[model samples]
Target: MAGSVSPRFARWLAFAGWALVGAGYAFGVLSLMSIGVFVLAGSVVLTLLVRRAWGRGGIAGLVSGLGLPVLYVAYLNRGGPGWVCTTSGPAMSCTDAWNPWPWLAVGVAFVAGGIALQLRRPAAAG
Candidate 1:
């Protein structure tokens, strides 16, 4: 065994998550924020499973799981991004999305840290 779960189980879990995410988007059963949450949670779970199969990398999952919430909270605090504006033949429209650069930087840091943890080896005792 590698860490906690088997590779076949992980693969099946991923397949199920993909189907669930597809259904959520296609059916509009989930709002934008809900979709985001679902995707992030899926990402964390899948990454942890893969890392576990990779052996002794499960600890890094904690850091990896932190990526989304940190960035999201930062975006919320920054009031998200200003609306996008477009004009055509005197018609105008606008839309918005969170585009916080600093938040992204922090989120990447957490993700990178998790990857680093997975790469590190535990010390051997004499």
Candidate 2:
């Protein structure tokens, strides 16, 4: 996929991901979450960069971007996002988000699929 897709585009994506990672790490560390959303996005971008650099399975790049976070969040929550629809009281209303495991699973699937698709095809086939 390297020649198939413009190298400029791939390099740009890689640069964007790495750049975001740097910025997010700088400011995001101060937040309560210990990490910022930008950093996560950056990780995904990095993965995409690797995929792009390898020259194949462009879709996997996006899929990995989605999967990495899903897996991370799932790991943090220890399975899912925890209890949803939390009714605290009039003072405050809190609700948990959906489980990341499902999304993570889907991401893993896509990543694997992308890898499989990008496998070196026989030159004879061409």
Candidate 3:
């Protein structure tokens, strides 16, 4: 396994996969519980892909993990400075969800955790 690819790289990929999926849940695009299930499922799939295809798992994980958050952010901000509520009861304002500082902090935490795990080599050995 380590003959063709570095274990450190593999771990980084796995961590990236987990992070991507985690961010999606964190931002509410995907429910928190759903993300938990995705992590378990993604682990098995990524393990198999890493074992057989070398860098494919990492690439996929990177794409999905990183892509989802970007997409979600774009979607959320599409209307610009306002909250689009799907539920009816009381009207929700942009202030309810458009706080830049807190969201930025949350994003930093998610990306930082991913990078830290990658640096720590958590996904080594397929």
Candidate 4:
């Protein structure tokens, strides 16, 4: 089926989505993150609506689209050991932290889903 969403446009959308996501994390801005997610989701939906939704281009677009949320959560739960200490003229303070297993698990799930999408059979073109 003919579509307004060209492969080049879809690719650009994916690139923009990832860029916004990365910038959001770098700047710690929720608004950027939210917009990035919506853009990425839109790219995937548009890809699916056009001809050959399961084709190589579409599959690549979908996998990259999924990366948007994956990047979001990755930043949210940047799992790593954490600790803080402060001292000022005999005054001291310390805080302990632990790794975010749950969030990391969610990231893994997103990755797996993307991989599965990549392996999907392409639909026969009309």
- Please list all clashing residue pairs in model 1, or write none if there are none: none
For 23-53, candidate 2 gives per-residue lDDT tens digits of 3333343342855666656655755665455
lDDT score, candidate 1: 0.51
Off-target runs (Cα >4 Å) in candidate 4 are 1-60, 72-99, 123-126
Q: How much does candidate 3 score in TM-score? A: 0.42
**Residue range 7-54, candidate 1, lDDT tens digits:** 555443433343333333322322345566666566556555554543
Return the TM-score for candidate 1, rounded to 2 decimals: 0.39
Compose the digit string of candidate 4's lDDT tens values, residues 12-117. Answer: 4444444333333332333454575665455445544442432334343344444455556555545434775668999997655345566456555655565455
Instruction: Give the Å shift of residue 85 in candidate 3.
Output: 17
The 10 consecutive residues of candidate 1 with the worst lDDT sum are 21-30
| Global local distance difference test of model 3 | 0.50
User: Candidate 3: misplaced stretches above 4 Å?
Assistant: 27-71, 78-97, 121-126
Give per-residue lDDT, candidate 1, residue 22: 33
- Taking every candidate in turn, the Cα RMSD to the unseen true structure, in Å, is 9.2, 10.8, 8.1, 8.6
Q: lDDT by residue for model 3 over 18-90, one digit each (tens)?
A: 5544444444444445565665565556556544644443443443354446445655654545554554568
Q: Which model is ahead, 2 or 3, in terms of TM-score? A: 3
Which segments of candidate 2 are over 4 A away from where they belong? 1-62, 79-81, 84-97, 120-126
* Candidate lDDT (C-alpha), each: 0.51, 0.46, 0.50, 0.47
Better of 3 and 4 by lDDT: 3
